[model samples]
Target: MGAGRRPSGRCLHTGGIVMKVSYREALKMALREALSNDPRVFLMGEDVGRYGGCYAVSKGLIDEFGEERIRDTPLSESGFVGAGIGAALGGMRPIVEVMTVNFSLLCLDQIVNTAATLRHMSGGQFSVPLVVRMTTGAGRQLAAQHSHSLENYYAHVPGIRVVAPATLEDARGMLATALENPDPVIMFEHNALYNMEGELDETAGAVDIDRAAIRRSGEQVSLITFGGNLQKTLAAAEQLSTEGISAEVVDLRTLRPLDDDTIMASVRKTHRAVIISEEWRSGSLAAEVGMRIAEQAFYDLDAPLARVCSAE
Candidate 1:
């Protein structure tokens, strides 16, 4: 695996070891690799440096990389986020961490206005190679303010790419790919998945952030979802299997650029579909995905499209 606390200078890949770790640990590994591999990469956000990250994902990074690389800023999302975008403009790869999706709204202008549109607005002469990461979805006792799945809000924007990493491998590796992209990328890490444990191959590295993955294969209904809801959907699929219903589970890793190909393909095979989202049903990513299936794979369905989504 990653041998030391600070595996310095171009050590992003690993091999030949299977280790069990929590989602939180996997993310730390990814951060370690990114900061170590690239001189241009640095992290800045509230509580990320001295406080060891809001969720403890960046716990040991400050000690490993120092405050300069693991910067801790004041509680102004818009200000610090704007600073990150400026760093990107100056040819520095910056990772801005907003504590939660609810707080990310405070920096909407910086993300949607500056970082997102810079490349196009500059007639392709410049690019904001920035990555903004924030925890999304609800956790116990956090209430409505700190707990919201606002993937659709960012997904609606055209210039930036949005990705929600569900599995352990994605949690560990997607950061690498997002950092590599020239345009701004928003990574929504589900609040509930931080402590979830699973086996991750040591060789895991940057994964494709552009496509959907089929978690399970079945001939009946297709259960499509992303982020924290994925585990619940997989459990639901297992229950359905017991009732003799073969449900195929589709993990929509990249939400914004919805993988219509994998989604439609699953619907075509299963001949039925159900989309699950933690976000409210109105204007949710589920609604967008369902509409696409209706337009492209409507004829192949054996039953009406269904959705299990948030009510509020």
Candidate 2:
């Protein structure tokens, strides 16, 4: 149940406790586990109850946790998000699920101004132990409005911690970690990754939400990305390997408190870097990564920094 080590066991064939599940299932499992472990943890969102979530991630949770814990709110994003903040402030840990990042704009004031800033403004008198989960990115062709990868917008703000769980382990582990955090945490899940299936260690529980992780190791180039762009970047890295290129892939799991050390170390080893983001080129997280590399790892670069981002 520790965050640092993956659980080991005997498989059915070999007697190990490994289970294969979709990314969506892993996320549901995490939520189910959080609710079962903490009575204060309740899930609130549109279509999260009888509708079983916008993406069906909470299909059977309502029956197990009951209606009080699995709350179904109206279409008012601002109202519910603010209520979640208030609930967190009052001693309840609320997991607010905004259907999409596009809709989160309706509650920017509640999230950035209230949930994020209360502790600092109150001189540490209050903290928002809240978790907001939403789908982000542009793979479903849901048109311009529904497909924005705007986790960067939240990441740019102060007082809030932003995390993107791009892999199965992270999807299963990070929510539990975020629930334990004293501050508000916004978790952005890529729209296209929900159905992605992979083997998950059944014992995977919590994970540290403070650092970045190197998903793939290499020495020729560093491909740094987070959230929706992680899988695409890893795929591109694999393609490059066929051409004899050694590309390293770094997943910036925690976005707000960017892990500068992990990123700088990757740049030092590779000497070249390419930052990618699902967001547009302007004011994107990839831009921040590029600038940080320029500022701290400038001497380590063997070539000019490259960026792969959406073209506006």
Q: What lDDT would each prediction earn against the true structure? A: 0.91, 0.90
As a whole number from 0 to 100, the lDDT of residue 56 in candidate 2 is 85
Candidate 1 local lDDT, 128-246, one digit each (tens): 99999999998988998999989999999999999999999999899999999999999999989998987788778999999999999999999999999999999999999899999
TM-score of 2: 0.95
Q: Compared with the true structure, what per-residue lDDT tens digits does model 2 show for residues 1-312? A: 222222233255354567767888888889888998899999999999988898888888888888999999999999999999999999999999999999999999999889989999999999999999999988676888888888789998888899999999999999999998999999999989998887887778899899999999998999999987788888999999999999999999999899999999999999999998888899988889999999999999999999988889
RMSD (Cα, Å) of candidate 2? 4.0
| C-alpha RMSD for every candidate | 3.5, 4.0
Question: Residue 72 of candidate 2: its Cα lDDT?
Answer: 100
As a whole number from 0 to 100, the lDDT of residue 191 in candidate 2 is: 84
lDDT at position 100, candidate 2: 91
Off by over 4 Å in 1: 1-15
